[model samples]
Target: MTIDSVRGAPEPELVQLLTPEGERVEHPDYPLDVTAEELRALYRDLVVVRRIDLEAVALTRQGELGIWASLLGQEAAQIGSGRALGEHDMVFPTYREHGVAWCRQVEPLNLLGLFRGVNHGGWDPAEHGFHLYTIVIGSQTLHATGYAMGMQRDGVLGTDRAGATIAYFGDGATSQGDVNEAFVFASVFNAPIVFFCQNNQWAISEPLERQTRIPLYKRAQGYGFPGVRVDGNDVLACLAVTRKALKDAREGQGPTLVEAFTYRMGAHTTTDDPTRYRLKAEEESWKLKDPIERVKAYLVRNQLADTSFLDEVDAEAKQVATALRKACLDLPDPRPLAMFEHVYAEPHPLMTEEQERFAAYLASFEEASA
Candidate 1:
């Protein structure tokens, strides 16, 4: 496939198997075969993550947290993409990927360390089979690329191992040189990685138009990969598309790009004033297509879940929020010496020297003040 420099000019082979109106649809290319239990788990994931996100935002507003990047409307995209990963697959995330982080078994409140200005990372990647959320935009792409390349070199991708790598980024990240470079690397080497772009239509105040004239997934042809767009608000569509993409990559079919077309229903961050840039009408529009509501409607229409289940879910949501609020408040700040770990694999000479200097300076302050 020759790369096209133009937008929306690429043929529409992308798959979307569900609609925002709580109805099942089909795409000839991507078929979904999931059980009821799977759907219920997906619903649970979306609910609990959204509740945690809402609590985090409230905490920020109430001064319980330093800041938060809420994943209000993008939970389906993140959780579905997360579910697509096999147990062996590894994940890399950006700072805003709390939804994905939650899916990977990392507690929601663990993310507060960085926002609270206490640490470089929230948790060890090895513990959760995920990398520390990188704050620098699009940087995780290279890490994912490198990891995939390593997997290829190990001959892992040559076999049907059900293992691959995934990197999550946002629409604004698509413009970064690192992202494009990652594409170049993945395409050239046929790396078994998925570049999952949550195109929630806004890169801060910048609209989707600012970054590309064409659809993001269509742009992947230039890099020698198939790209698909899903109804990110429809969790089932996200699951179907991402599962196929990861399967293709793991089967040595090379990389794929998934553009989860969703929306961000909140400010870019706790510090942001989105009202200053976007229209109130747009938020209202997306709210009507709420991911959680769509799923709830589907479950009720199909009798997969009843009002009692939903009420129970609602109660559980509140419990989750309360637990997260307490966790954020109770989390201890990082120890003074805990800062010296994880900057590098080997002992970093410069960091060691700085740590000593910092210790000396702190000691001098106490001596002088005393």
Candidate 2:
């Protein structure tokens, strides 16, 4: 069914705890008790994350990396939801979740390895409770649902210390078959997972209009679960909504769908030219709603941080970016033979034959030179 078919007369209101003007607001059901230091820390996180993205983009342009999928405007959505997780919680991420990876403490160099073509994935899932970036669109949703089912079977739900799984996808992924099937499975089994869809208003060249005429969250109602739309640019709102969803899942309340409504301030990837499909006016409009700027404004307005503190964060962010560039440049290229090494857990006759053939081909070139 089309999104317009399922949508109500009016789109559901977004859950917002902070306005674009940096004003603090309150929600009746979702309350946040953040200290001044914590607020400052969150602002730091946003700044560093954006710096990381900027450096990566520059690297791509300079031919140091193959390509980059920038999380330029969606930093709040990723960092906010990422920080809400418990130590044992698991996350399945889309390719652009650099901010979330940072919150999970995954090394920055590891992320660069993927774009640098040095490795398929750079970090262990178990080590950081973060899955490898999934480039196949909505595939991670199914993986997350299956994982949550395993958690339920293991009696890991309905406890104070219980953990939940979060599946991260894009607005475009909601149209995929895998995502819909995941919704069905999670709903039927009541899996303790959160489907976090970062609806950044564009599915590559396609706008939100191309995906659905209705708000994405409303689709969850038909699947026997509750869904809420949150202001993805508002870090506090994202954190609050995600925290509540995780708590409910841990308590055996089943799955939740969180549609984070935000905008992608950059092209789909380094290879894309957004000037073709989108407008200059549109880009300028979103600049006013910038995620990082709002947090910086709030910190300054509330006297939670000063020029010295903000400057310190800026300095720290620069160091991180510099270090990332060095690490990326220092990474050694993988040997050609390395491709066949990790294809299977156990060796197979066909693989052995292929490896031998490849080795003989390499030796032939050496022999000819001799």
Query: Using lDDT as the measure, which candidate wins?
Result: 2
lDDT of candidate 2 at residue 12, scale 0 to 100: 72
TM-score winner among the candidates? 2
The collision pairs in model 2 are none
Alpha carbon lDDT at 104, candidate 2: 93
lDDT of 1 by residue, 107-175 (tens): 776687567767676687877878987889999999999998888888877565657899999999999
Following a full C-alpha superposition, what root-mean-square deviation does model 2 have from the true structure?
A: 2.0
Q: How accurate locally, in lDDT, is each candidate?
A: 0.85, 0.93
Q: Please write out the lDDT profile of model 2 over residues 1-370, one tens digit for every residue.
A: 4344464565478899999999999999899999898888899999999999999999999999999999999999999999899987999999999999999999989999999999988799999999999999999999999999998888978765588999999999999999999999999999999999999989999988888877899899999999999999999999999999999998899999999999999999999999999999999999999988898889899888899999999999999999999989999999988989878999989999999999999999999999
- Model 1 — which ten-residue stretch has the worst lDDT? 1-10
Candidate 1, superposed: residue stretches over 4 Å from native: 1-14, 118-122, 158-162, 341-349
Give every collision pair in model 1.
3-222, 7-214
Q: Name the regions of candidate 2 deviating beyond 4 angstroms.
A: 1-8
Question: What TM value does model 2 have?
Answer: 0.97
Global Cα RMSD, each model = 3.2, 2.0
**Error at 283, model 1, angstroms:** 0.9
